[model samples]
Target: MTDKPSGKSFDKLTRRQTLAAMLAAGMVGTGMRSASAADFAAFNPGYAKNIVMPAFAQLAAASESLATAASAGCADPKAPDLITLQQAYHIAADAWADAQMFRLGPLADGQRAERFAYWPERRNIIDKQLSALLADDDTISLDAAKLGGSSVAVQGIPALERLLYRDEPLPPTGCAVIQAIAGNLVAIATEAQKAWQQAAAKPAPFAANPTEATTQFYTNLLTLLQIVADQKIGAPLGGDVAAAKPKSAEQWRSGRSLRNIRRNLAAAQNALFGKGGFAALLTPEQSALADNLKKAFADAIAAAEKAGDDLPADVSDESRRHLATELLVKVNHLRDLLRQDVPPVIGITLGFNELDGDGS
Candidate 1:
C-alpha cells in the first residue's frame, strides 16, 4: 500500500507545490499559534518525553512519505484490488499526516511560532498529497498478495461490506470504525478543552518556564490526539471508496470493514477495556491494544439478543459512530479512562506539571 508513482504532480510537490502549500497555510512562516496553558501540563511528561514528541515527529515524517506515496497513485486503477490498495494507502497516509499536523508549530519553525495557519496548510497538503499520490496508479501493481494477501481472504464477502454501497462509498463497517475513533478524538479534545476552561476558573501562573513547558506539552498532546482521531477515523468515514472504484461495492465494503479493525490495530489502538473486560483469544496483534479498549462486544450482543436483534447486526449497531459507531461510546469512555491507562511513555514525566512541582 505504500509504493508511490513518481509523476509530474508528485515531482511538482517536491519542487513547487509543497512550498505553496506551506506558504498558503502560512506554515512557511506566519499563522498558527500554540495551545493554552492547561492542555499539556496535565499529562505525565517523563513518560511522554520518549513517547509523544518523537512518535509525533515520526508520524509526521512518515505521513509525509505516505502522502507522497499516495499522491503517486491516487487517481487511476486497472483492477478492483489496485483500487483498494490505492484507497488504503491514501487513507493510512492521510491519517498519519493528519495526526502529525495537529499543532503543527511544534513541527514548524519560525520567529513567532505559528500553528493555526500552518495546520490549515498541512490540511491542504494532505488533500493534495492524496490526489498527487493517486494521480497515476498504472505503475502500481495490483498483485493481490502485494495489496496485503487476499484483502478478502475468508474474506471480502461479509456484512461489513454492506456499508460500502455506491451511496455510502466508504462502506458501513469501516466508516463506523473511522467515525468511532474520530468521535473519541473530538470528545477527548473537548474534555481537554473543558479542563482548560476549568483552569481558567482557577487560573494559575504559567509564566515559569516549567509551567510554560507543561502547558505547551499538554496543548500539543490535546491537539495531536485530536488530529490522530480525525485523520484515522473522520476523514476516512467521509471518504469515497468509489473514487478508487473497487470491483464491487461488496468488495469495497468488506475491505473497509476489515480496515476498521486494522486502523486501530496499526495505530496500536484498542477497542476493549475496563469493567466486564473479557478474557478472549488475543491475536498477537490485539495484545498491544487490549488494555485500551472496552470488552463490550459480548455485552452488546447479549443485550441485542435480549432485545431480539440479530447478534452481528446488534453488536455492530452503534449508538454513536466512534468506537460504538464501530463497536459503545460509553464503554469507549471507560476505555478512554483506562488510557491514562497505557503506552510506552505513559509515566515518563511524573508530577512535572504540579503547581510547584518544577517540571525539570
Candidate 2:
C-alpha cells in the first residue's frame, strides 16, 4: 500500500501555501532570516543526488532482479525456483517501499503511481481480476505492455502478492501473470530511474523552484505520517481492537506492514532533515522543530521495529495496540511540528485548508 491514494486532508493550509503565508506572519525567530532563493537552489542538487536519484536507481535495479527471477521461475515453475522468486519479491518490495517517498516527477505522471503499486484495494479487486485471468487461460495473452494497460488491480505489486501468496497452487496462467507483472514493474522502474537521472543531470524546473520542492518535501513527509497514523494503523484499528481489520494492513499478504512504515519514516527523515536536506535552510527555531521531528520519527521507527514484524497480529493484541497508538501519537506530533512550528521558521505560511489529492 505504498503511497496508496487517500481521501484525508490536513485541515490547515497545504505545506506550500503555508510556507508562503509564513513569510508574511513575521513568525521567523529572532536573529533568523527567511531562506533566500540561493539557499533553496544550493540544497536542491544535493537533495536530488543524494536522496531522490538513488531511491529510483535502487528501485530500478531491484525491479530488474525481480523480473529476472520471475522469468526463471515461470520457465521452470519448480519449488526451488519459486523460492528464489519469493526472495526476489521481498527484496524488490522493500526497495519499492523506500522509494515511495519520492512519488513525484515521472512517478506521478500518467497515473503511474496507481499503475506501479495500486493498493488499499477496493472490493478485493485484485483477487477478482487475478481469478478471472487465471480462470480464462486462453484469454490471457501475457504481454507485459498490454497487461500493464489492463486493470490496474492486476498490473502491480498487490496483484503479484495475491498470485504468489494465495492459498491455492499457482496455475500456469498465474505464473505467466507473475512474470508479466514483474516485467512491467521492471519497465516502469527503469523509465522512472532514467527520468530522475536526466533531471539530476540538468536543472529541471523543480530544481530551480526550491520553495516548491521544499513544499513538496514537507507535504510528502506529512502525508506519509498521516497515512501511517490514519490508514495503516488507525483505519485497521478502528474505534478499538474489537473493530480492527487485520486484513486492512498494508502488505498483509506479505506480512511487511510494519516494515513498510519504518522505511517510510526513515525516508521522510532523510528527505526533510537529513544532511544537505531542506532542513538546512531552516532558521534556529525551525532547526529545533526539525530536530524534534527527527527524534519523533526515530522513536516511531524504533517502536515499530520493537513491535516486531507481524503488524496485523500486533494490532489485535491489547498491549501491542497500545504501542501502535503511541507510535501514531508520535507521528501526529511530528506532523503538527511540520504544520505549525517548522513552517514559520522556514518562512513558510499557513493556510486554512489541507492539500487536495495524494500528498505524495
Candidate 3:
C-alpha cells in the first residue's frame, strides 16, 4: 500500500485546498460592497493622525537626539560618548525605518526621502563622496547647507555610518563632518515633519478621493515588501550558496540590515491592521482574508527576527544562510497576498505591470 502523507505534507495540502476553496467562493475579486464612504473617510485621516504623524514626530525627536549625541561625542571622543552616539544612531535609524513607509505627501516632495537615506547605492557612492569631502575638508564644502546641495549619497545615513563605524578614531575634521551630517539629518526630518503637520490639517490628496488615496497607501505597502525581499535580502543572499554577496546588504557596516527589515514589516502591519487602518474597511465576510494577511506579515517578521542582527554574516555563511532565505520567502508571500487579495477586496484595481518600476 502507498504510504500516507507525512504530517507537514498533509498540512501543506490542506492549506492549498482551503485557499482554492476560498478563491472559488469569490474571495479574491469580489469587492466588498459593504465598505462605506464613511469607512474610507475615516481611513485616510485616522492613518495620518494615528500612524503616519506619530512616526514622523518620533523621527524628528530621534534626529534631534542624534545630533546632540554627535556633538557630545565629537567634543569628548570618550568610549562612553561614542557608545551613547551609537545608541542614538540606532534609535534614530529605527525611527526612520518605521516612518519611511508613508512615502506620501511631504516625504515625497523636494526629494526629501532620498535626501534622508539613499539606498541601493550600488556604486559605493557614499564612500567615494565622503572620501573626497574629508580629503578636502574645505570649510565651505563641509557646511550643512553646502552638503545639502551636494550629491544625495553624502548627505544621509550611509555617509554618517561610514564616519562613525571605523577602526581609527575620527580625525578632528572627521568629527566636524559627523556633526554636519547630523545637522543635515535634523533639518531634513524637521522639514518633513512640519510639512506633514500642515498637510494633516488639509490632507489634500488623501481627502480628495478615498479610493485613490488608499491605492497610494497600498502601493507603498507592496513596494516596501518587494524592496525587502528583492534588494534587502535577495541582493545579499544572491542566486545561491556560492553566489552570496554579503556586503550588498543594507547597513552591513553597523549590522542592522535584518533589524531594518523587521522594523519595516512591523510598521507595515500597523499601517494595515492598526485601529483606523485599512483593516477598518474590511467587511465581516472578509475577515478570513484579513487574518491571512496578518498572519503573513507576522510570519515574515518572525523569520526576520530569527535571522538575527548580522544579516551580512547570515547571508554569507552557508549554514546560516537559510534563515535569510526563509525570511525572503515569507516576505514574498506577504507581498503576493497584498497584491492579489487586498486590491480586489478594497475595490482598487492594480495593473499587472503596476509595481514594475523603481518605487524608491
Candidate 4:
C-alpha cells in the first residue's frame, strides 16, 4: 500500500476559510466600496479556477506521487528505483515553479511559500538543517503531520535535492525523512489549493476592490518576470561572465535551472492571458504591449530550452553567455512594459517593488 499524508493538513485552510466564512456570515470586507460591485464585473474569475487553484492542485498531486516514490525507494536510496523517485521530485518541483508567482492570499500566509522551496541559499540553511535533522533520529518520523511542523529547511524541494541528487551515500534515516518531507509538501499544497478555491467562490474575499485586485494581479506577473531575471539567471551570472557562480543557481544540484525558467515563463503567460485571464481585458494599446510581453517570454523560453538543463554552465560559457544575457534583457523589457504601460490603462498605478513593496 502506498503511504499517504494525513488528511488534516489539507483540511487546515485556517486563514482563507476564515475569510470566506466571514463573507458567508455577511461581513463585508473592510474598505469595500459598497457601490462598486459592477466595477470588477469585467474581471474573469476563471484565473482562480483555471490557473491558480489548478496549479496548487497539481502540486498536491505531484507531491503525493513523490511521497509514494520515496516510500518505495527509501529502503534503497541508491537502488535503480531511485531514478523514478528523482523524476517524481522533478515533476513536483516544476509544478512549484509554475505556481510560485501567486504569492498573495493563502500562499503568503504561514510562511507556506517559503516552506515549499526556500531559494538563493543565503546561508546554506538547507544543508545545515538536513544535516541536523538526519543526525537527530529521535525527532524524525514518517508521519506527515509531525514532519510538516519541522524546520522549513529540511522539509521541501531543496532538502529533497540534497538527498536524491548528492553523490554521497544516503544516511540510514534519509529515506524516512524523504518520505516525511514529501508528505509534508503534499499537505501544504493541498491546503493551498483548498484555500484558493474557497476564496474564489466568494466575491467579497477576492473582488471587494476590483482596482486593487487587478493591480495585485499585474504586480505578481511583473514580480515573477523580475525574479526570473534577477534570481534565476543574474545571481549565477554575477556581474560579468568571468564572475559566473554556477552553484548559486536554483536547482543547480539537479541541473534543472533552465527547465525551471521555462516552466516559470509558461505559468506567467497562462496566468496573464489564459481563459478568463487578464488578456481579454486589455485595451488596444495595452494589447500591443501584452503581445510584446508574450513574444519576449516566448523568446526567453526558446533561449532557455536551447541552454538545456545545465543552465549554470551554459551561463558561464563565453560563447553561450550571450543567450543567457539575451533572455535577461527580454524579461527586463517585459517588466518595463508592464511597469510603464499597462497599469495606467487598467486604472491602477504600479509602484510596489517586487521584492519589497516599499517602491524599491
Candidate 5:
C-alpha cells in the first residue's frame, strides 16, 4: 500500500506538504560553514542519471509488457495466458516498488502515483468501484482516456489485481477492465519516464540546486522509511496479537505484501548507499555514521526477507511475526539515524518545531 491515506491529520499531509515541512525545518540544507556547493556538485545529476531515470525506464518497459500480456489474456482467457499475465504483473509491480521511493518530479504530477496502485483501501473502494464499472452497460470504462478520468480505485494495479487474481475466470467485461487498466498504466509509466528524461536533461530548480535536491531526496528517504514501518507493517500488526489483520497488508491478495516491503527497502538503500548515492557525501569523520546506516538498512532488508512472501498468520505467530517486528525496529532505527544524526554531519539543521513531533 504505497502512500495510503489515513485518518490521522499528519497522515493526510500530501507528499509536497511533507517536503515543505522538511524544508521549513531546515532538514535539507548545509548548516556547516565548511560545506560548499562543490561538495555536492555531483549529487543531483548522479541520482537523476543513475537511479531515478533507470527506475522509471524499467517501470515503463515493464508496464508495456503488462499491457501486452493483459491483451493476450483477454483474448484467450486460458490458464497459461493468465499465468503469463500474472508474471508480467509481478514484474511491473516490482518495478513500481523500486520506482515509488523517489516520489518526486513527474511521479507526483496529476495524481499519477495514486492512479498507478491505490492501496490500503480500508473501505474496499477498489472492489466496489470495479464491480460498478464491470456492471455498467456503457463502454466508457473500456476507454483508457475515460477510465483514467474515473475513480482511481478502478484505474490501477489494485483493480487489475482483483480482476486477475480471482478463482473464477474473468468475464469478457473483466478482461476489458484489465486491458483498460494495463493501458492506463502504460500511459502513466511512459509519460513519467519521458517527463523524467526531460527534467534530467534540463534540471529543475530542486535538481539543479544541490541543497534543495539533497533536501528532496533526504525527505523522500525518511518518508518512505516511515511509511514502511507505520502503514505497511504496523497497520496489519495492529495493537495486539488478537487484533492482527493480515488482509490489511498491501497486495495481500497477490501474496506479495512482504515482497513489496523488501523491494521498497532495497530501492531506498540503493538510493542512499549505491554508487553516487548520499553515502558518498559523508566525510572521513562521518564514516562511522555511514557504516551504521548501511548496516541498519541491511538488517532491515534481511528481516523483511525473513518474514516470507506474505505477512504472518497473526501477530501472535512469533516465528514469523517476530521477523516483522524486528523489521519495524530496524527500519525505525535507520530512519532515526538519518533524521537525527545525519543532518548535523551533512550540515542540515533540524528546526525546533519539526523536532517537536514525529512529523508523520
Candidate 6:
C-alpha cells in the first residue's frame, strides 16, 4: 500500500476521518442497500424468513420512490436534485456506516479488519455509482442552494458539516447511502454475536471452529440470515421480482446502473453459500453454502408464484396469513439447511479457538 502519511500531524486524523475524506473524494461501495438478516435466508437456511428482508424492502421502496418522484418532475435519474436525493443517500449511508462500525467495532481505536475493511471492499462501490448521478454544474441548482441554507428543512438535525460529507448539495447520494448501509452490517454482526453468546448453554457448537476467519465468516453469514428470514419485512420473502425486473421510468433509465448491487449480492452470496460463478472467491465449505442457497432462492421463487401476488385488495386476514406463512416457510427451509451446515463446518472442520488470533 502507498505508505500512509507518517508525519504525526498528518496521522492524527482518525480512520473515520480518513474514511470521510475518501467518501468525499468518491470512493466505491458494495452494491445493494445494506447487508441484513434477510441475507441470512441464504446463509443460515432455516431460522425464519422475512427477517432481514424488511429493511431492504424499505430501502427498495425509498429508492424506487425517489426514482418515481424524480421521473414525475421530468428530472432525469441522472439529474436528481441533490437535496431530495440527499435524504435517500444519507439514509443508505447511515445504514452502511452502522454495519461497518458493528463489524469492525468502535472508532475509538483505529482497526482495519474490524473498522475500515468494508469501506474499501464494499461501500466504495456505492460512492462511485452515486457520484455519476450529477452533471458538471458543480454548484447546487439555485433553488436547492436556498434550501440548503434553511434550518427548517432539515428539522435542525445538525448538519454533518464534516469534511467528507457536507450538508446539502451532495456530490454522491450513494456516499450518504454508505453511512446508512454501514449501520445494517453492524446490526448483522451484533445479532450474530448475540446468538453465539446463547449457543454455549444450548450446545450450539459454533464456538469450536477450526479457524477464526472460517468461523467468523460462517457466524456472520448464518446469524444474519436467521434474523432477516424471521423478520420478513423489506426485501420480503419471495419478493425479489421488484429488484430483478425494473418497472418505472427511473428503473428503465438507470436500468443497468445497479450492476454493482447485483454483483455484490453475488459476491456476498458466494462468501456465504457459493454459486453463480462465485466459487473461486470462496472456500470449499462456502461452496457448499452457495449450493444450499441456490436451492433456497429457487424454492422461495417457486413458493411465491404458487401463492400469487394477485390476492384481492381486501383479501381476508386468514388467506393473507396463509400466503405469508407458506412464503416464510420456503425461506425458512433454506435457512435451516445453511444453519445446519454452520456448526459442522466451523466447529468440526474449522475450530473456533483457532479464529481468536488469526483474523487481522
TM-score of every model versus the real structure: 0.30, 0.85, 0.85, 0.84, 0.88, 0.33
Evaluated at residue 102, the lDDT of candidate 4 is 84
Identify the leading candidate in terms of TM-score: 5
Candidate 6 — worst ten consecutive residues by lDDT sum? 152-161
What's the lDDT for all of these models? 0.29, 0.70, 0.74, 0.71, 0.74, 0.33
Model 5's C-alpha root-mean-square deviation from the true structure amounts to 3.9
TM-score leaderboard ranking: 5, 3, 2, 4, 6, 1
Task: At residue 153, give the lDDT of candidate 4.
Answer: 69
lDDT of 6 by residue, 192-255 (tens): 4444334322211232221322233444444334433432212222243323211211111222
Off by over 4 Å in 5: 1-12, 15-33, 77-80, 201-208, 312-319, 349-360
- Could you give candidate 2's per-residue lDDT for residues 1-360 as a string of tens digits? 222223232222235345433443322344435666556556656777887888889999999999989878777553426677789988888888888767546765544656778767776767877788888867347778777677777888888888777787877677778888898898889888887777763333242355555555555556667777787777777778898898999879888788888888888788776665667767665555666877877777777777678878877888778767777777777777767666656654433223334343
Q: What tens digits encode model 5's per-residue C-alpha lDDT throughout 265-291?
A: 988898878876777778888878888
Report the C-alpha lDDT of model 4 over 1-360, residue by residue, as the tens digit. Answer: 221122333234333444433333322244332323343444625566677778888888899888788777765644536688789999999999989998767776676876788675556767877888788876445567776776666768888889889887777777777888888888889888888877764443353454455556666778788888888988888878879988889998898888898899889878767886767656675656777868866777777777777878777888878777877777787667767765555555554533632121
Position 346, candidate 3: lDDT: 72
Winning model by lDDT: 3
TM-score of 6: 0.33
Model 4 poorest 10 in a row by lDDT: 1-10
Model 6 misplaced regions, further than 4 Å: 1-83, 90-210, 233-268, 273-293, 301-316, 342-360
lDDT of 3 by residue, 255-303 (tens): 8898899999999999888876778777778999988998998899889
Task: For candidate 1, write residues 1-360 as lDDT tens digits.
Answer: 222223343344334423322222211112312322343233323313323333444443443343343334333222123344345444433343323322322222210111111121222232343233234353133221232121111111121122123342442123322222222222323332333333332222121322333333333333333432333233333333322211211123233322332333323221122121111222445455554443433433332223231222222334322332333333244334433433212211212111122111
TM-score of 4: 0.84
Candidate scoring better on TM-score of 3 and 6: 3
- Given candidate 1, what's the lDDT at residue 166? 34
